[model samples]
Target: MTEIHPTAIVEDGAVIGENVRIGPYSIVGPDVKLADGVTLEAHVAVAGHTSIGAGSHIFPFASIGHKPQDLKFAGEVTELIIGANNQIREHVTMNPGTEGGGGVTRVGDNCLFMVGAHVGHDCQVGNHAILANNATLAGHVELADFVILGGLSAVRQWSRIGTGAIVGGMTGVEFDVIPYGSVIGDRARLAGLNLIGLKRKNLPREQIHALRAAYRALFENEEGTLRSRAEALAAEQSDQPLVKTVTDFILEKDDRRFCTPRSED
Candidate 1:
């Protein structure tokens, strides 16, 4: 049986699964659904056509499943789909999608949205990602698996953050971050490979080494061209998984929002 506080307002059409808990003063809107073991702390509001997966916990004052803030939103039926085991901390906000940019905002499993983090409409956030305090993702953003956005960082609309990428604190990212790479500062130049993160993820030492070499070749070498270096490395280290990953990332990047290397003066 679901446990809902007396002060909580759960609309008629809302579905609350077994063992779900709705805390004091919370509101579950008409089109909302909370799966088994989901918990919403005090003052949380879940609106629109939203579904929270099992074992997810939303902290106090979090406002999720809100309508898109986009001016293009026309009261259409959009959705916010959050996967299991996500931890949404206090004051966080996640908005649903708009018709112009699909009709759903999706967040995968085992992610963490820290305090004051905001995920704008039409964003696709992958599994095991972390949005630190005040990290904001604008509409139409895509964060691949294992990506981390540090505190106060903001990613622009239509940008893609590749798998295992890390954006440093207070950075302003206007471009797509490369897979397994790190970006930092105002314009968010590519810092280097996320060595610490890769190591923590238990990637093999040989793979890490190969990736380090590939990073230097693509970003630090005299050639200063990612395509040619990536191609050569892929050919030379065909058997290595890291080399293949690098090759795939460089070749598959969408032109709109790719990270820029620092100018060599």
Candidate 2:
């Protein structure tokens, strides 16, 4: 049985699953679909063609599935697909994709969007990711699984944060962060590997050590261009899956520059 507050406005065509609870003054649009166990607290607005999966809890004042902020968007049909078990805190905003941006924004399961965090149009956020308070992701940014955006960190449009990376608070990330990388400072520069994150994941000590070695080989080697060195290192470490992930990330083509360690480090 769904529990809807008297003040809530669930449009006629909105699909509310069993055990869903919509709080006071919340609005669920006609095209919206709330899966089982969804809880929308007071003053939430779920609009557009949004589909939120099961067991997700949205706090008060969240604005989800809104129109894209892009100037090129002329009310074209787009969608926002959020997976299960997410915690969307107060004042968070998630926008739908624009026609030019593949017409969909996808968010994976178990993510946390903290207070005031904003996920822009066309962003793709992976499972177990955390966007801390006021963390902002510009349009088309891709956050791989286990990535953490610290408080007030801002990622530039089209930047990809690889798996297990961490962006420090108040930093501006303008490049693609490599797997397991840790970055800090305004106009963010890579600091080092996310050793803490790696440990938390309980990766084997040997694998962690090899990933570190692979990282240095790609970034610190001076014998040749970084790309050539990455290729060579990839071949040498072909047996190590973790090393392959790092090397493949470095070699992957993208418009954004790869995040490199600070010169002072």
Candidate 3:
């Protein structure tokens, strides 16, 4: 039951799944595969080795699986794999991986990429992520589950955003953000825990309190280095899993700078 508009151009070798809709003037390349219930609205261009998962709705003017913007890309066989039930909005651009970045870009399920958002080559986006209008991720960036990037925010290359983090609008993130961290600044600085996001998940109040305590200890306590503070927190026996999530994220082996609170004094 695949439906293709009369004006659409689906290449001869394209593999379109059942109940997929290809709209007016859209182009599906030979190596592209649209899974079950995928809807490609008018003027969408899906090129390169791209396979969009089932039930994803790609809006008009979206450029999926396009060539990587990296100058080092040399026409290698790369891929962009988008997960299920994503909402890709108008003018969003998602590029495939280059040889330098393991040759594949992966986006997890239930993502909402807003208008003009860009997912750069080899970026790994986890489930329940939301990129607001004009939000951008540079090459090889990683976003964990429940991460939200506000409108006009941009994450620098190779930074990792942890689960339950919220990046504020117009912020430029140059460092790795810890889980449940709320960041906002001209250049992103740790604001606090993402309490709104945690509450939206219906997380228990005590658990959130524990996370907040851990945040203060790790970022505000003028005792030890961030990793040392995190390690000390990890040694504590706590019933709150979210606290451990933040601590473990800090303890992870990444050389990137950790986003921290601006000096209050």
Model 2, range 83-195, lDDT digits (tens) per residue? 99999999999999999899999999999999999999999999999999999999999999999999999999999999999999999998889899999988898899999
lDDT of 3 by residue, 87-135 (tens): 9999999999999999999999999999999999999999999999999
How far does residue 215 in candidate 1 sit from its true spot (Å)?
0.6
Question: What is candidate 1's CA lDDT for residue 120?
Answer: 98
The estimated TM-scores of all candidates read: 0.95, 0.97, 0.97
The true-versus-predicted C-alpha distance at residue 144 of model 1, in Å, is 1.1
Better of 1 and 2 by TM-score: 2
Cα lDDT of model 1 by residue, 26-86, tens digit: 9999999999999999999999999999999999999999888998898999999999999
Error of 1 at 253 (Å): 4.0
Between prediction 1 and prediction 3, the one with superior lDDT is: 3
Model 3 scores a C-alpha lDDT of 0.93
lDDT of 1 at 130: 99
lDDT of each: 0.90, 0.93, 0.93
Model 3 misplaced stretches (Cα beyond 4 Å): 263-265
